[model samples]
Target: MTRSVYVTGIGRGDGRQVVELGMMELLTRQVDRVGLYRPLVHDTPDRIFELLRGRYRLTQDPATYFGMGYEEAAALQAEQGQDALTARLVEGYLRVAESYDTVLVLGSDFAATNLPAELGVNARLANECGASVLPVIGGRDQNAESVVAEVRNAHHAYTNLGCDVIAMVANRVDPDQLDSAADQLRRSLDVPVYVLPDEPALSAPTVRQIVQTLGAEVLLGDDAGLARDALDFVFGGAMLPTFLPALTPGCVVVTPGDRADLIIGALAAHSAGAPPIAGVLLTLGEKPGQDILRLADRLAPGTPVVAVPTGSFLTATELFGLDGKLGAGTPRKAETALGLFETGVDTTELTERLSVARSARVTPMMFEHALLERARTNKRRIVLPEGGEERILRAAEVLLRRGVCELTLLGEEDAVRKKAGDLGIGLDDPALDIVDPHTSPLRDRFAALYAKLRAHKGVSYELAYDVVADVSYFGTLMVQEGLADGMVSGAVHSTAATIRPAFEIIKTRPGAAIVSSVFFMCLADRVLVYGDCAVNPDPDAEQLADIAIQAAGTAARFDVQPRVAMLSYSTGTSGSGADVDKVRAATELVRQRRPDLLVEGPIQYDAAVSPVVAAAKLPGSAVAGRATVLVFPDLNTGNNTYKAVQRSAGAVAVGPVLQGLRKPVNDLSRGALVQDIVNTVAITAIQAQGDLR
Candidate 1:
């Protein structure tokens, strides 16, 4: 099954960039598909879809994705009664829900008021679609009660409408207040509550905003005079043609005199019932030739054109770069979606506190004392793949500046230096090693491993070099060959691209049979472990047992007890099938293999999750409910279910911390946002420290 999560409520000014960035974060955790659905979008089209479609290459259509099929519900509200409009909205939402695994229903701007009725509509739709409703409340203030009330109201509406309440997310909360607000909501609400921190990293510059930031004025006709913001700016003469379709209203065309024809033609096409051209800023102090001017006049008469005194288009690009206005503040809707993912909400802690429950297993140490001691005393080698990139450089700089660990970047010295120079970043430190894959002594070792793995399949040494040159494989080989303490990749690659090479070269830990993943969910009050979402699909009992053990180990590493809950569709003897049987057998195997483990299985998610539900399901079962580590039977069930809980239940999901590698190594998705990369790096660092133990 294709892994998917549905997202909605995207058409507002609260910066959907974070949503896009956040969704990219989810993608790294191995979710194959992400669907956006806005059941009742306003009459005005949301520009995010256009931006995402063009810039991010998102294939889903914005019109249909948002569920605004020609007639918008807001438009219907004026003609029909509110109830009728609500029904239409609900119908649209239901249609979207059927196509995706987890549906993220966005509340309108008037969620404080309109949500009461809208929530009912969504609840009915959720029930019909068997989807979870994650209410994402976008706000600027830290009024805990108001936020809690909004969440509760949505939950109440959904519950009253005969749907389950999953979670509530407080979007755009100030960083300082994020913890407090999350805490307040967690205490007040029965379900999980997450506060998405306001991260400026995800915001991309709008063309209008970019123009304004550069101190350029717009002069194109009426629409040009109208204030518009550019979603992003494109550079290079070669890219101008490709970027034209991505141009929205208020897009300022910045180009050189040599490309006047290109600029004029693009502007003409854009102004023809197009969104609107913010204006054109001619670079290189060159005016259009007579022929170009005549064409511009005929195509877009009176279009405002500004000329910069810069010597060349490249210089103008550099100017924008120097000002930090080059695609830096543009909002990415995907990041906003990711920020909506409920993390840092301690659902287990809350559940235990609310129900006065105790875990069957003893709590672990606050910190891994032995590991911390080892990290403090030893010089640990950390490998970062695609080290030539700006983000990785910045991360490495951070680690170096803080004296955290020794950093190694995988790249050729000259190319890395050149790229670093282009970005105006200099790394002069001797501690940082720029290892060229071709020249490194360890290259032979990696080549040998590559040959050993592929030789049986008719791959030769020469072929192995080309394949292993991919940093994912190269970096994994570094760990396998004991050249690095840990390896971190995936920023420039997919999960498969990152992990497959590792699986082939490094293989799993000696005793571990299958590789799996677990996210250490950090909430305001506590942390819960969610597993098998990042790796493994349709895991049998043995694989499930392995996941359970790994999740428990991860929980322990993070200072939490391992009260493992093997999640299934049924609770105890209530349901029977291969899926339930897998969970039950896994539970039995976990007990047999590791009697020290406290585990329960063949349990419904709620029963495995809630103490109240657990008590009701099995009166005296030892591990009936207070389980901290949730081990899913398969990727399909784990990924979709976790996202449902993350988005709808308001649980902040943190990881798919890749486990079972010989050394701690993890991957990042190619489109992962900065914060996600930062967090993954931090997690990888911590995991590296864990290996010292």
Candidate 2:
């Protein structure tokens, strides 16, 4: 039977969607082909279903997952009986389950339907589908004791109905009460319980949501502007001075459309970014005249300005009632929700409890998710040298949003701030620090340290001062001085410039012969390691063996079991040449040094990766065709092969991750995308986790 999990809530406004989305994230991290099923939905399109399909790239037809609409479900229950309704729902669910390795079943929303005793109905569906129940309890307006009591009652209710209650989640608890509620539940409950505090971002209405709810016209703004979350509602009824003082960051200003002065002032404020408003909402169906609108456009281009037919009072009422939904349209909300869920829940233990077998094949998405989760376990501070670059700033926003690491961006504070403002990235976050390498007080100290380290080269204090002012050298010095755990740079610089400072300051590890690199080639089914792809040009036999050892160690650290394959043009003794001889020598050295490692050499690419080729040429060899780590004899072969496979096979090549450094310092391709920068930062953080220094 296919394993299934039912995420249900005891009452409305529990914010159970967070739990449901988090569960899907967890399932996808372990297995591919995970399915989603909604036992009952309202008449409209399911927002959460669309989100899952888009986010996870699910190809399954949406119709297959919906058991039935709530109206039909209610009619079936009322007319035929409860048993008849459940049987039909189970039949629909089973169809979805059979096609997937595991299925996540979303239970009915209690507020949507007029069906009575919704909890009992959900329990019956879970029991009939043979699914484990993960119940959610709302702690929005309740005290710590009430939250605890509610969880206890919910656990018993599900168990009494013969539903296998795997765990319980209490969401939207007050931050102050989170600890108390969690401790009480831990002592009282037999099973595990997770608590998530209320997040304002998840609840704040977006400009798009307001426009949709009010039936307003978008006279101005783009998709980016409409996506801004409205954290506050500022009514612009007073004069410019009073209204300007009341304006807050992420606020939506509501005023009569004829009030052109207030509109221009608000747009000017948003342009200056003193406190960026989410948008401006004009009431009474009035729009600013062409001249005023043209001026407003100059002040803040693409800033959202909408018009609604309703008056100011009615608009305020509607705005206050509207809340954001965690759906396909709101990606920022999804990130915030995932961050909250991952931080509060013990997902490792929860997954173990589910007893879902881990798939042997690791997809690209699965590998990326594992990197993030592992990095978060021991958060490290990483310095980015190219802080002024656009891609770096965007990647920093994503990293901070996901709670990935502490970042110190090296650039002039004023310039970086202006650029971030232009990109609409908030720079006031506590986890991020912007530094000017030239004017910082630490520059003198760093220069002194550098002079001492390079004293034998006859480098004077003045020369050292100039050298430390370079961003790459400054960031590398931070890592060497233990001020930062790792560093990721080279988005705008060459690989040589990024690591040359490391070569001078950090040096190699104790037992390492030379610093090498590897590219984690994320293919469709699994991830393979390709070494010396971005570092060495033409390493000797001894250096080749060392690279193999380092690559294997790197693979093992990331949970990819190491099976070393030394690639050459020849398969075993089929050919004779200097290249084959070099590979054969390296293979012998690896076996002699680390006898425990499974290694094969002088193997062609096809024989190394293809089972049929291995069966014909090198039968029964441990690492013949099952190689997870491929060590190239030279950089020319490694680099070209990785690029070919990446382009031809549609693989995601992450790295040129520098191995054997004393402290972690990785380089990004100058043409790296935003996601590539994010991945490199995460990899650097994870590498820092193992450093005892």
Candidate 3:
């Protein structure tokens, strides 16, 4: 039977997309095939459905998911009565449900639709579709008591109309009143209730939204800059001296294009990091001269500069009316929405209630989601050495917003703050700490500690003092000294620069013979662990065995069942060579040492992963075709293979996550994306949790 979850709001402005997107994420995590159905949609493109399709990578055709447009729905309900309308919607939903393990049903939006009593209609549709209802109530303007009453009323109305109300949500509630609202709902309602505090990021429109809504020409900014949420609108009227003080972070400055002084002044302020504006909007179809525009580009390279034909009054009218939407183009907003939903809702309980069967395969997104959820369970402090990098700053914002872990970004406090401000990252959160290793008092202490620890090898404290000032050494020392639980770096530095300090200070774990690394190669269907990919150019038989053991342990820790495969050029001793001999020897060593581990050796990649090849090459071997942990003979092989799979197969390679470290110190590629940093940070936090325990 296909389990259906219908996320419907009482009215518009409920921000129910958060609930809808959150449910989609949870569903994807649980099932391999999930479908989405919208009973009624506006004439315009369904933004929420598009977002789900893109974000979840749904393969269903758009036409199959939408039952009918609002006009068609209203016309049908009027002409043939509500029963015919309900039957048609149920027919569409059943078609979608037939092919999917689960279907997410979106109820009608009460936005200018002539449908009578939308709540009752939604209830009827949900009841007819056999979807458990997850009702969303708008609490934007409601007091705590009123919000509680609204939830009660919504839930009662749904139940009265023969809908199975599985849960209730009070969305966009005031942050300060969340606890009050939640408490009142708990006492007043019988079903589970979740309250999401109003997130300004979700509500604020992006520069792209502004461009599209006003049909403005993009005169500047990159896609990333345009994705920035405009938090406040600043109308440019005052002089530079007076207007500068009025500017706030993430504000979009609107003014006549002839006001070159204000435009340049705002861009200069943004460049200097006093306040980062989303973009500068030129009004009345007038723009500055080429010289001024050139200077503005230099002032803020990626800041959006757009021009509109309308005057300031009309532009402001459209800007004020524009609200942020979740769609194909707005990924940051999706992240923010998911973060808000995950934090506010009791997903475990909801999952149990939904009774979604778990999928056997773990996709890349599922792996990343698991990492975050595991990290958030017991939060740890992770130190990032590359604090000034834009990617690092953006990833930090995601980490903080998701409440994954506390972070200490190692850099000059002012410079870090300025950079974060320039990127529109909110640095005011207490979970974030900025440190300047050169000036911090801990620098001296760390230097002294380093000198003492390395006194046998080195002769001078002066050398250690200078070395500890570097962010990598500072972060590694923080991990060693227990100031931070883990460290993730190398975004803007070499891997050697990031991990060399770890070797010097943290050293290997107690039982480990050598430090090795594994890349969580996330393929389309499952996540496979590839060992010794980024470290150890070559290893002897003993070192190879140790790497295998460590890699297996790492795999087990991350919930990948350890069916060890010692990968080689040969399969099951079909060929003989120095490389195959080393792998065969390592396989024997692993079986002898672990005794309980499922180990197979001298296996080719195809034989290790493909059951068909395994049957022909190495039949009846427990670890041949079902291997989760693949240990390569050397770094030359492991590195090339992982890279080949990553590029050719479109796999998401998540690491070079160092194993056998005393404390968690993971290194990233210099070209790592913001999401890569986030995953590595989460991995480090989870490792820190194990270390702490």
Per-candidate TM-score against the hidden true structure: 0.48, 0.93, 0.96
The sequence of per-residue lDDT tens digits that candidate 3 reaches over residues 1-693 is 999999998888999989999999888878889999998888546788788888777889888988888899889989999999999989999999999999999888788999998899999888878889999999997789899888998988999999999999999999888899998889887899999999888999999889988999999888777888999999999989999999998999999999999999999988877887888999999988889989998888888999999998988888999888888888778878988999999999999999999988898878988999999999999999988899999999889888899999988877887677656677888999999999999988998999998999973689999989999999999999889999999888998998899999999988788889999999999999999999899999999999999988889889998999999888986899888899999999999999889989989999999999899989899988899999989999999999999999999999989998899999999899999999999999999888521
Q: Judged by lDDT relative to the true structure, which candidate is superior, 1 or 2?
A: 2
Q: Give per-residue CA lDDT, model 1, range 183-202, as digits (tens).
A: 77768877776677664323
Candidates in order have lDDT scores of: 0.60, 0.91, 0.90
lDDT value, residue 498 of candidate 1: 79
- Give the per-residue lDDT digits (tens) of candidate 2, residues 249-311: 888999999999899998888777777788899999999888988898778777889999989
Task: Name the candidate that leads on lDDT.
Answer: 2
Error of 3 at 325 (Å): 1.4
Candidate 2 Cα outliers beyond 4 Å, as residue runs: 43-45, 258-261, 289-302, 388-390, 414-429, 455-459, 691-693
Selected candidate, larger TM-score, 1 vs 2: 2
RMSD (Cα, Å) for all candidates, in order, is 16.0, 2.6, 2.0
Candidate 1 — which residues are off by over 4 angstroms? 1-379, 389-391, 422-424, 439-441, 452-455, 620-622, 649-652, 690-693
lDDT of 1: 0.60
> Where in model 3 is the C-alpha error above 4 Å?
284-286
